[model samples]
Target: MLSAGPTPKVPLDSWEFVITTETGAEYRWSWSELMALPQETPRVDIHCVTRWSKLGTTWQGVSLDTLLDGIDTDAAYVLAHSYGGYTTNLPLDDLRGGRAWVAHTFEGGDLPAEHGGPARLLVPHLYFWKSAKWVRGLRLLSADQPGFWETAGYHDYGDPWREQRYQGD
Candidate 1:
């Protein structure tokens, strides 16, 4: 688990976890509420832009589809925000159809803060940076808005199989 910032501290109190949409609707769920949702344990292969790959890593989290279910929107992208002020953007499609989750567990245990505990956006199909550790919320967008890494010239869409690691790669 690598990041550009220190691990953020999770609040001990009950706070709302929100997902905002481009249409101005917000769905806020408590941590317990999220845990109550159907959980999935996906064995995914994670590739890092830095050249490290972890295969078949187990993660437990609520599927993005479940969270977004019945929420009406025409958005095509998502900006995932983390507690420590980190953010990443991805095509909303990459997060649907069992492709992503807001995971709170790893390897059948609580996910450590350094590993995006409490909850983190997990889009295993992309480079690990797109996972956005310490994730807190998501903001839907109609356009392809760039987040931290993309603003820094990293590939807007990070596909490991295509070896899309940098601006010109």
Candidate 2:
């Protein structure tokens, strides 16, 4: 498990997830509301930019597709924001079509805070850093915006398989 900062202990009652479109429209889901949404247990493989790979890990959460349903946006990119102020950007398309989820459980148990409990974005197809642990919201943007790691010289699009770990990799 890895995080850019200390774990945030979010109270379930105050925890909420929001989706902000480029037009500033906001859609929100509280903890109870989010738990009521359809949930799926995805068994996936995750690779980190630091050169470690974990296969067939199981996670439970609502799919990004489900959360994005009915959201009206013409944006081409998305910036995932976490509770601790960590952010990561990705093409909007990369988050749709069953590619991602906001997971709250891992290995059949509630995710530990050390592991981004409450919830975290799961984008297994990309390097684990793109997962944005402790995720709280996604901001839809019309243009590309580099997030924390990207701005620190990490590859803007970190794909472990392609060895896209550093800016010039």
Candidate 3:
């Protein structure tokens, strides 16, 4: 479940992105890289399949609009590649809205590693799974694909508004 919150906005100026490998190697992302692509800071509400919802969340990250700025998206969908081969696919449109973000900072602090630090995909409009934690990269695809949980019976499109959770929801 997601956490319920009045959702406070905290200054994220000092939050530096940190990447830790399974072998314990740590790398810090430079501001140039963080801002290499166009980024958007949005005040959004998050809904987790776990059922906790946190409102008024302030997040900062590269927006799909910014990332696809000069490149042609050859695929009809995208694969959210994360640590441990965790991934989720979504139609191009789903990633377009200003609603989606690759958030690097949360609640005025660098996101904790336990909470997908370094970077995480924040799909505020969908169930949290759609927002892959510990995100690394995004792969464009020609067709829709399912990820680990999806193959295990979770809904393919985790839309929070529709309350899509388990199969046949």
Candidate 4:
């Protein structure tokens, strides 16, 4: 697994996932609460910007649609925040309609910390970097805000199929 920095170990008991709207309103879910939500096993092919591809990987987790249900917001963008201060941005639409999930299990087993154990954002359609590891929350924004990689010259919309890796790609 590729990481921008060292892996972080987050305890499950204190783990929490939050979604904050542009209006400052916050929605939260503890580990137990998250686990109780409806879960789905998605088998997808993931591609990395570095030219590596992993096909037919299975993951179990709550769908972003399920987690975002009942939320009221007009934001058009989202910034995913992770436990180790890692962040990534995506169009809000990309996260809905079963396009994404907060994955916690891989291949029928608990996800290891090095692989974003407790939870990670899974956006298989895009390059792997768009899937923020150790995801802690999502911040809704009215305007696009570059995250860790985006700010450093990575493409704002990292579509692997189109080879959108660097800013000019």
- Best by TM-score, which number? 4
Q: What is the full ranking by TM-score, best candidate first?
A: 4, 2, 1, 3
Candidate 4, residues 10-66, lDDT tens digits: the string is: 999999999999999999999999999999999999999989999999999999999
Candidate 3 worst ten-residue window by lDDT: 1-10
Q: In model 2, how large is the Cα lDDT of residue 93?
A: 93
TM-score of 4: 0.99
Q: Model 3 residue 74 lDDT? A: 55
Would you estimate the TM-scores of all the predictions?
0.96, 0.98, 0.77, 0.99
lDDT preference between candidates 1 and 2, better one: 2
Q: How many backbone clashes does candidate 1 have?
A: 0
By TM-score, the better pick of 2 and 3 is 2
TM-score result, candidate 3:
0.77
> C-alpha displacement of 147 in model 4, angstroms?
0.4
**Candidate lDDT (C-alpha), each:** 0.88, 0.93, 0.69, 0.95
**What does candidate 2 score in Cα RMSD to the true structure?**
0.8
lDDT of 2 by residue, 21-132 (tens): 9999999999999999999999999998878899999999999999999999999999999998999999999999998999999999998888888899999999999999
Clashes of 3: 7
**Candidate 4, poorest ten consecutive residues by summed lDDT:** 111-120
Sort every candidate by lDDT, greatest first. Answer: 4, 2, 1, 3
lDDT of 2: 0.93
As for candidate 1, its clashing pairs are: none
Q: Per-residue lDDT tens digits of candidate 3, residues 1-169?
A: 2222222232335434443322334444454667676667788888878889889988778786665554544567767766556777766678785767778888878776667766788888888888877676666667777876787888888888898897798
Candidate 3 whole-model C-alpha lDDT, 0 to 1: 0.69
